[model samples]
Target: SSPLDPRYTFENFVEGASNRLALAAARQVADGSASGVKFNPLYIHSSVGQGKTHLLQALTHRLKAEHPEMRVLYLTAEHFMYRFVQSLQTQSALAFKEALRTIDLLVIDDMQFLHGKQIQQEFCHTVNTLIDGARQVIVAADRPPVELETMDERVRSRLSGGLLIEIGAPDAATRRSIIERRIALTAQHMPGFSVPDDVIDFIVRNVTTSGRDLEGAVTRLAGHNQLTGLTLSLTMAETTLKDLIRVTDTRRVKIEDIQRVVSKHYNVSKQDLLSSRRTRSIVWPRQIAMYLAKSLTLRSLPEIGRRFGGRDHTTVLHAVRKVEEMIGSDEALTQEIEVLKRMLEA
Candidate 1:
């Protein structure tokens, strides 16, 4: 009834290659005997629709069910701000503080919205009081603490001090599994509707960004099939979701644009990426920038290298190769590059 309530407990969460480590960490924290056993103030960050809120809610619900005596409070950033503002207006700040301080577990979702100086100050005070009093705090956001722009330094530092975990976008296998799970759930609602495996594969391949997109596609397919008395087919699904599938336009991002985006993301001068500095940080970003430049632009290696501070074509080749390997192996790095690519294209 309510969008399938994504908060699956640890028992229901499907383990896959994409989120095995994160699931383990969450389980450890939830089952920890004393406060701060495995991870205190667990911070989960991910892009939209990657199950961050689901995991946070699941943890909160599981803890409350297991320990009936523990007090838990869960609120989104907007709700938290609203309550804080209302308390100030009604002269009830102390009451709000007291209620929050007495909770055994505090869960905040979409914390990136609370970036104002005043709100951040209040958040810092709340965090300090809860941690000092040995209460567990869990926060979710779209980005990590260090990357949170406009947030107070004290709040950012405190958030980063705890265990920080990031959930990556679902890979092809994970997406396929998600598609199957959603289709099965949909079948429960619509007994006569069915989707073929090829259709599922097609949806997974095309909508490869996030789990939310996949679920939306499945729901749309189920609804259309029910309304029109039509069988779900690959062609129909494609036609229905033409806008959701992102087709890269080679003309949009040029080599120079890629370099500019990468430089800005890393906060390094364009010359640094082009320079012969073998530092790990610079080297990886440089390679990724070059790889994106070559992939997105019509420029040759020599031309791209020349644009990046007169480096040799062979250097550009090496950087491209290294980045390709890293993207295939390192999930976090792949997501970082994908985010940069999205920004560059936008």
Candidate 2:
């Protein structure tokens, strides 16, 4: 199977002030004609769901189609680490390095999750080798190189040497276009699926977080319409997406904010929450913070785990489920989490 998602091609990407420059740069890289040395290791950063992965894969797809002979490899930072670890276990680290170094184009996603000393050193060496050979490299992350505190400075410096672009949050017009595109795509599959302009405008105004959320809102409406045999209406949109609408007006919540608020509420230090204490005091607060981060932010489980002291993504999932179970059975805990949520959102 192809590593890239077919749906995330450049044709489907919505352009706006937020991501226009990033899109143009990505197209240039795909065409193998970007200005000399500037965009070789094109570094793209953004918060969650801001089309970094889409543009990366779109570039990969175009490169594969237009220059089929070029050796292109696209994988997330997690997968790269996994493969390196596997190579070490199998005693084929040399072969792995050789293969990676020889690729014509390299695309790494979620660079924030890349940790550990030896792996990062190897990554830096590979990037240097590829760039020195005039190969193209692209990387995406949740934040810019300077902000990746866990990553090695050498890796950050190498990435910083190239073009760094950020995809900002979509404005109102981009949000509308995204909603329209999603509705159009859905209509292709379900011919009766359509969102009225008023409903569309309602979604644009209220689902103001990211393109993914807007797509999700439209999906929910389409599901309801298909199941209940009712035409889309502003009332139905409001009713179906009440939760999203409620949070849209609030400031965007970050994982750091969740950790800080949860720590303060539980009377524990933020460091304690990120520590491996395993005591009830630290564990509960830690779990609560993870749950809040999962619920209030768009971070993936692994990304949340990385934020919370490099715990495994399954650990974050377990914490979330534990907090959820307690909230159902423990009123005080439920009230406490509610208070924490309000504080974070506030």
Candidate 3:
């Protein structure tokens, strides 16, 4: 049987600007109409707990419902590795390969963990064969295909030649809806176990990490109420979730954190941001890091400058101003900065 989660269907998946494109793409793939080949190998990517797995499983569910006779397989990259090795040990490698090739729809999750040279080659072959035979394939990873640095180049290129959709972090409104949904679901099991508006706002404001964290907050609160018979209050939530809040609080964000996140997000290096290079790629990330340092941290201009390649305070000021000006005009830059901020805060 496939390892699909029954709770993660499209009906329950929350919709927002962050995940709309991913959801739409997933729906189109599930429909498997004339456009099936157009999105043959749909690649959905996002940071952990941003609903990447949920969307993949939702599509798997819909595909199974629409084509009951069709074969569907959902497994993680790690599990795939295990099964491949097991088949080899049991002298059933050919059977494993045959079973995999016959699947009508293949959904692979956590593909970033799909390591090992032989495993990736097999994966690439399976993907190419299935796609060539007009079967559906869907994969999800923490980052885009290009960022799967350890995977085979051929595999990356093959996945890249499909519909790539990124599910960004949920904004405030989306976060609010997620929290309320979690609370409502919890109340279904435990009568009158509700979070007050003020408490909900506090959780939404504090847990700026991911929907998974928001769900954890609600679960934690519900657990406390069930055991302690305590009424949910803002103060109680503050005290109970202080550990979660402390980690994601923006006030605690540091320059090094900004540098690391910016470097990874842009595929640049922390050293590159600190280097004297003047290339557009390097300069843009440096300016963004500097701007984030000024906004998120309390370091003085000179202090921040000292940390980032020991430049002058004036440079930091210029970067802050430059980013501020762009935020008003450059919509992409605005979103990029927002994503970085969420990463740092999380």
Alpha carbon lDDT of each predicted model: 0.78, 0.88, 0.87
Best by lDDT: 2
What does each candidate score in C-alpha RMSD? 10.4, 6.2, 9.7
Model 2, residue 25: displacement in angstroms?
0.6
Residue pairs clashing in model 3 are: none
Query: Model 3, clash count?
Result: 0
Show model 3 residue runs off by greater than 4 Å.
249-346
Please identify which of the two predictions, 1 or 3, would achieve the higher lDDT against the true structure: 3
Between prediction 1 and prediction 2, the one with superior TM-score is 2
TM-score of 1: 0.72
lDDT of 1: 0.78
Order candidates by TM-score, high to low: 2, 3, 1
After superposition, candidate 1 runs with Cα above 4 Å error: 1-8, 33-38, 247-346
Tens-digit per-residue lDDT, 69-168, candidate 1:
8787888887888888889899999898889888877888888888567877988888888888777888888778875646799999999998888887
TM-score of each: 0.72, 0.74, 0.74
- Candidate 1's clash total is 0
